[model samples]
Target chain A: MTREILAVALLAGFGLATGSVAAGPAEDLKVYQAYFEQHFPDFTPEDYTRGMYNFSQDKRAQYEAIMEFPPYEMAVEEGQELFATPFANGNSYSNCFENAGIGIAQTYPRFDAERGKVMTLGMAINDCRVQNGEEPLDVVKGPLVYIEAYMSEAARGKAIDITVPDDPRALAAYEEGKRIYFTRRGPRAFACYHCHWEAAGARIRGNELSPARGQAANFPAYRSKWGEMGSIQRRFKGCMEEFGAKPLKPGGEDMANLEYFHRRLSNGIPLNAPNNRF
Target chain B: MPYPMISKNVALAAVFTVMHVVTLPLMAQEGKGASAAATGNGPEAAVEQGKAKAIELCQGCHQFKGADQAGTVGPPLLAMKARFPDPAKLRALIYDAQKASKPYTMMPPFGRNGLVSEQDIEHIIAFLYTL
Candidate 1:
C-alpha cells in the first residue's frame, strides 16, 4: 500500500514537473476562449476580431467610423481582378480552390494530409500559381496581401472552422505550434502567452494588448501604421522583431504550424477580416 | 565540368561563412560588461535617476506604488524592500528574469539585452527600496 502510494505520488510529481498536461484542440479552444472571456467579461467572442479596438470604446468608435470608408476597398477590387486573371497555361485561381475560393478563408492553416504539412491560405495561393504555370507571388506582402484581403472579405461573418485531423503528423504539428506559443525566447524572454494570455486586455505603455482568442479571425488587415494591407505572417514577423528574436520564415512550416494552433484557438468565432486597424 | 566538386566547395564556403557570422557577435558581446560598473553618483541623485528610468521603461508594464501612470500588465511592484532584502537577488531578477523565475516571465532581461546597465540597475534597485 505504501509503495503504491509513493509510486502514484512520484508519477504525479513527474507530470507536473514536466509541464506535460494533455490538451487537445478542443480543450485548447475552451481554455483560451475561457481565459479571454474571464478577463473581458463585457466582451463577446466576436469583439476580439477587431484586435485592440475591443479594449477601448473610443478606439472601437474610431474603427467603426473608418470601416464606413474602408481604405482597403480599392485593394479588394484589385484583388478580385487578380484572382480572375488567367495564367499562361489558361488556368484561373478558381481551378485551385474549393467553391472557386469564394468563402474559404476561415478554413486555412489546415493540415494538408497529402503534403504532410500545414497549409495556410497564402501557401495555397502560391501552390495555385505554381500549378497554373505562373511565378509565385511574395508570401509576406504586396499583391498576395490584396488577394488574401479579397478572400478574407468573402470569409467575413463565417465562423472560423479550422480542423486538426486525428493523424499523428497533424497532432504533432498542432503540438509543435502550441509549444511555440508557450515557449519563451528572444532578448525579452517572453512567450506569446505572456501578453496575449496572462495580460490580455492589459495596457502596455499606451497600447492595449489584444487577447489571442480571436486574433486569427481578422487578417490581411489594412494597418494604419503600414499604410497598406498586410498578411498575418507579416504581423507575426513584426511581433517577433519586437521580441528581439529572429523571426521564422513567412509561410514556412513553423509559421504555418503556429497559425494552425492559433486559428484553432479561435474556433467558432466569426471572422471579420480585411478590416482597418490603427 | 566537375559539378559535384564545385557544389561541395560552395557548401564548405557557406558553412565557414555561417560560422563566422554566428561567432562574431558572441565574441563582441563577451567584452561588453566590463565597463558597466556603478557611476559615482550620490545616493539622492541615484534614486532620482532610478525613478526616471523606472517610469520610462518599467512603468509601462509594472505599476509602482507611487507612480501616477498605472499598468496592469504585470504584477504591481510593491513592498520591494521586504520582498527583496538582498539587492543582489533583485539585480539578478532585473538582469535575467527568466533565469531567476520561471522561463515564461514577460519581464525583459534589461541587463542581458543591454537595455539597462549595471549602474542603471543599481539606481533602479535604490528606487525599488524606497517603494
Candidate 2:
C-alpha cells in the first residue's frame, strides 16, 4: 500500500481498538489542540506552567487566615478534649478503642462481619461516644467533624495504611466502595471514571485534569472557587452537581465508604490538608 | 529700518505658511486612514483585507457570531469586547497573543500561521474595534 493509505489504515485500527471510533488520531489531535487554544488562550508550553496548579497568592493568604489547625488536626484536638470531658455517667471516649491512639483513625470504613455492615471511622468515633453512655456527637455537625479534620491532620505525616482485615466483611465494603465509584447514577450518566480516570491528564476548558490517585491527599482543601473552607465530601458534592447527580449528605455511610476507597487508592501519599485549589 | 524689519517678518510668516500648508493634508490623510481602518473601512482597503483574514484564521474558534457556545473551546468573543473594553489592549493581545501567556493558551503566532501580514494584523485590529 501507499504510505498515506497505510497511515490511514493504522489510525483506523488504533481507533477501533480503543473504542473512540468517531475521530482518528489527526482529527482527535486537532480537536484537542482547538479545545486548548480556545480555553487556555494564554497557556504557554513551559516548565514553570506546573506552578499554575497551586493556589493563587491571594487564595493562599485567605486559606492561612481561615484554616488555622487543618481540619483533622482540629478534629483530633476536639476529640481528645471531648474524651477528657465526660458525659452524665462520667465516662470518657478513650475507653472505646483498643489503644486509643489517634493514628488508628486512618484505617476505617472497614467491614464488620459480625454486624454484616460497613463501619466508617466517623461512625466508630460516634459509636464510642454512645457506648460510653453519652449522647453521641453528630458526625456531620458541631466541632466533632472539625475535630475529625484535626485528627486526619495529626495523622498527616503517617501514610494511608488501611489494612483490609482478611475478612469477608472488609472485602464486601471495599467492593461496595468500588461499585459506588464506578456506578453511573447521575442524570448525565457519567461515572467518576468519565472525568477522573478516563479523562485523566486531559484538559477540560482551561484547567488540567488531576489524577484521581492524588485526589484523596488534598482533602479538607481550601477551594478558592467555593470561597469557603470545605472537606472532601463537599468537593464530592460539587462533582456530583457537575455530573448532574444528587449530592449525598455529609457524614453519610456512602460518602464515608467512598472516602475509604479513595484514601486506600492514595496509599502512600502524604496528607496536604486545608489545601488551596482552583 | 522699518522696511527691512517688515521684510524679515513677512519672510518668517511665508515660511510658516508653506510648512503648515504642506504638512496639514498629509497628517489629515494618515489620520483618516487610521480612523477608517478602525471603523472597518479605509481608502487603502486594509480593513477589508483584515475582515477576510479574520474569517480565515479566527472564524474557526471565534465563530462568526462571537458567541461562547458557538466555540465551546474558547471563551465567547462577544464577552471579549466586555472583558477587554479597551481597544488598545485588545489590539495588543491580538498582536502579541504568544507573549501575553495568560491562563488560556493563545492562538499560534501569526508568523507560524503564514497567513497574517503586518497590514493584516492592523486591519484585524481595526475590525476587532468595531465589535
Tens-digit lDDT string for candidate 1 (B1-96): 211122322332243345335544543465432222222245665567678779867888988866777677878889999988867677778877
DockQ of all candidate complexes: 0.28, 0.02
Per-candidate TM-scores read 0.81, 0.50
* Candidate 2: C-alpha RMSD after superposition: 19.2
Q: Which residue pairs clash within candidate 1? A: none
In model 2 chain B, the worst 10-residue window by lDDT is B1-10
CAPRI grade of model 2 = incorrect
- lDDT tens digits by residue: candidate 2, A174-259: 55565576555443344564455434444444344555555766555545576544666777778888645787776777787777
Native contacts kept, each candidate: 0.65, 0.00
Chain A TM-scores of each predicted structure, in the order given, are 0.91, 0.65
